[model samples]
Target: MRIVVVGGGYAGVLAANRLAKAVEAEITVVNPRPDFVERVRLHQQVAGTAVAAGPLGSMLRAGIATRVAAAHKVGDGTVTLDDGSTLDFDYALLAVGSTVEPMAGTVPIGSWEGAQRARAALAALPAGAVVAVVGGGATGVETAAEVAAARPDLRVRIVGSPVAATFTGRARRLVRDGLARVGVEVTDDEVVAVDGGDVALASGTGFAADLVLWAIVSGVPELAAASGLDVDADGRVLVDEFLRSTSDERVFAIGDCAGVPGTRFACQSATDQAGHAASALAAMIAGRGPKPYSVRYLARCVTLGRRAAVAQFTHLDDTPRDTALSGRTAAVLKELATRGAKFGARAGFGA
Candidate 1:
């Protein structure tokens, strides 16, 4: 059987990698870049602390075919590439991820290339200038923490989210404590405009910032809407319990791009959802019963800096514990989990 996967992101890459190994099937990955962007660590990239590329060739079993194309159209069993080329397949997976959110109304920063460049801006700024990070989600928290860790001289001020977008209460407090430990100042209001390095708040408060960073977005390629797939209001591709595209059974969707229950855009969720997509697809190809998908992460960690972090443990249900961990111990767990999940791609479900 032949299968085509769109987007080389966390979901697409893991699904393609697992499926290629499971069925010995002809697999094709369609993405613009040759290597996958480790988007989860993009904040570190912006801080110039980590590399941006990931193991694309090895993840795909080292031999699966890949095309440098952005999917503009997807159907029952066909994908139309950006270059006007088309690939027909027996089964298709629409994992095309999101694009950056349009900031206010201007250009939406898409791709790690832009993210890396955003971080590069920090390098040339005045050494002891104040830095303002807008948004209070994971990306914002991580970015703030990394900047504080990397540049102790810069006065860092973070505006807490108006909405509880990432974590709340304990989680939010954990982040606050972590930031405080790293010498970052937290504010409750949002920045309305960025003029040069000066950030204007909605209440007419202006922050003298040498660097401004936006950290409250998860962008995909908009393939779900463009391909005519049924998507949720949040712009995720709607899928069934087994990760099959709701509108087209021949198509499967996974990862952050796919709207699966309890499956988030995190690397952990992407890895777990990949097994689900692979199993169901393999079952269909082999004329067996497809299995439904469910996800629950073992431990969740958020890093405060190089030394401290918080570990939120869950039990089947994704409920976090009241207290959190900080310092080197939590940092080690977070680091291990990220690295471990990368290797866990090799252990996929039966196709």
Candidate 2:
């Protein structure tokens, strides 16, 4: 049997590696880049810090074939590459991940190459230049904090999002205080348009800046939908409880591309989903019943800077607890979590 995984991001890589050991089958991972991108550290990259990206070979288990090519299309039991080559497989897993929503003339940290370009553009800006980050989600929060900490001379502001809406009251207070300490301004308004070095808010407010960073995380790739796979309104592939596509049983989806209810695009969720998909596939291959995929949220951490953060403890369904960790301790934990996410796939399901 042959299995083809059409992506190499957190979900794709983990699925390929875990599936390789599940059965005696040929497993191939198709990716455009040769290295694994630690997406959690992309905010650091934009702040001109070292990223956790490394060669793909370093992370994948031995015996898994790696193809450095983009998947152009997925047909019945076949994956077509950008170079016109095709790979036939008994089963295909679509984990193409996601990209940031297009905000013309702004740098978005949703893709590997886009983050690199954003880093360069940010680094080249002059001191005291104003940088506005739109979208106050996790990416926006981290990017604003990182920028403020890294370039103290520059003015950083986070626009959009109510600031820590997912956190408890105290944790939300910590986030607010941490951003203030880093000299980052928080604006609770939506960005309707971005002109060259200018941002127009939905409330008719406008601001000029040297650079604009868009953190709209609502963007998901449309590959699956375009290829006729069942998808939700946001173009995320709809999958069954076992992570198999609802439209085709031979196809599975995970990570940012999967339209699993209550699932987010976090690294932890991706790894967990990938492991579950592999386990289900292994069971099917062995003629055993596959287990249903289920996940729970433990906690969510947002770095205010290198030395400050807010770790919001949560229930299994992600409801915030009344207590939260703040200050350097939370910062350390956040940093460790980001680092661990890079290699978390190696632990497989037992982890």
Candidate 3:
């Protein structure tokens, strides 16, 4: 069998590796870059503290072919690359991940390319310059704290509605305290527009920002939509309980691009989906019944610079619990979780 996996992010890489171990299909991974980017550490990359990407050749298992080109279109049993090349497959896994396109005059730190640009822009700024991060989610809080810790000379502020709003009340308080300790100012304001050097707020307030980093992800890639596949309103490919595309039985969608209910855009969730998809595909190829995909939430870890973190325990459905961990222990746990995610993708153990 010939299998083609599109987008070599966390989901695609894990799916390919796991599938390689389960089935005897000829697997090929198509990605725009030759390196595998650890997207969770993009904030650190922007802050100039860590490298988030490395050689992709070292991550994937042997015997899996890789095409260093963007997938322009995914058709029935075929994938067309931007370089005018085509690869026919018996099954295709669409793992193309999320993307971000910030408004004019603002740099985005969501993707690897955008993180590099943000890093260069932040590095070129003068001391005491104002760096405004527009988003209050995990990415925004992490970026704000990282920048403040890395460059104390620069003023860092995170503006959004109810910063760290996803966590429980107590966990949210701990995140705020951690951010404060790292010298990051949190503002409960909604950003309306980003001009050359001014950020207009929804309440008619404005702030001068020497550098603006957008941490919000816009949406997933348009590969499925452009190819006339079933997609949700957000352009995520629609998949059934087994992670197979609703429109095509031979095509499976996982990761950020897959419209999997109750799943968040996280590496852990992506790897879990990948593992399930691989197992199901293998079962079907072996003429056996496949199990439905299911996931259980463990914990959500957010780093406040490198010294502190908040690990919020969640219920099976991913709802936050009142109990949580903070301080150095939480930081260590967060670090271990990050390393475990990388190891899981490379070693094909945890999914």
Candidate 4:
């Protein structure tokens, strides 16, 4: 069997590695870059404190071929690359992830390249310049705190709704406090429009900043929809319990691109779904029954720069619990998890 994985993100790398070990199929991974990016650390990268994750060749298991090209189309048993080349496969795994929804005149910390651009823009700005992060979600909160900590002279503010609405109890309070401890201001408002050096909020408030980083929302590309695959309204591919596309049994979807009910757009779900897809494919290849993907939410870790963090414990369904790990312990745990994610991908599936 020949399997083609159309991405090199967390999900794609894990899925490709698992499949290579589970079966005798020839596996090929097509990605735009030859190196693996630690997306979870993009905020740190923007703050100029990112660790190296090595290249894609070192992470993927041996015998799995890789092509440095973007996948433009996915057809039955085939994938077309941007270079006008096509690869034939018995099955295809669509792990193409999502990106930040772009807003006018604002830099978003979504992709690796975008984060680098934001970093350069921040470094070029003069000291004492005001920097506004337009969002109160995890990414926004983390970015605001990181920027404030990295450049104390620069005024950093987080402009958005309640910080980490999904996190309640102590976790929510800790996130707010962590930001405050780092001299980051949290503003409870919505940004309506972004113009030159100014952001208009829904509360009739305008914040003029030297630079604005928007992390309000994310969006998936049109690759799956254009290829006639079943997707949700947001272009997220719909998948069954086994992580296989409901419309095309020969295709599997994972990561932020797969619409897994009750699962947030997180790296944890991506790795879990990748493992499920690999096992399901192996079961099918062995003429055995495949099991459904079972995912459980444990904790959500958000680092407040490098000094502090909040590891919010969650219920199985992702609802926050009253308990949490905070301060240096949480920061250390977060760092370990971040490092583990990067190196684990290089260790192959089930490592």
Identify the candidate with maximal lDDT: 3
What's the lDDT for candidate 1? 0.73
Error of 2 at 59 (Å): 1.1
**How accurate locally, in lDDT, is each candidate?**
0.73, 0.84, 0.90, 0.86
For candidate 4, give the lDDT of residue 292: 87
Candidate 3's residue-wise lDDT over 230-341, tens digit each? 9999998889889999999999998889998898888878888888898889899999999998877898889998888999999888988888999989989999988888
Please give the lDDT score for candidate 2.
0.84
What global local distance difference test value does model 4 have? 0.86
Best by TM-score: 3
TM of each candidate vs. truth: 0.91, 0.96, 0.98, 0.97
Q: Which wins on lDDT, candidate 1 or candidate 2?
A: 2
lDDT of 2 by residue, 79-133 (tens): 8888999999999998787787758988888677878888999899899899998
Clashing pairs in 2: none
- How many clashing residue pairs appear in each of the predictions shown? 10, 0, 0, 0
Which has the higher lDDT value, candidate number 1 or candidate number 4?
4
Clashing pairs in 3: none
After superposition, which runs of candidate 3 have C-alpha atoms over 4 Å from their true positions? none
**Candidate 4 error regions (>4 Å):** 51-53
For candidate 1, the 10 contiguous residues with the lowest summed lDDT are 102-111
CA error at residue 72 for candidate 1, angstroms: 0.9
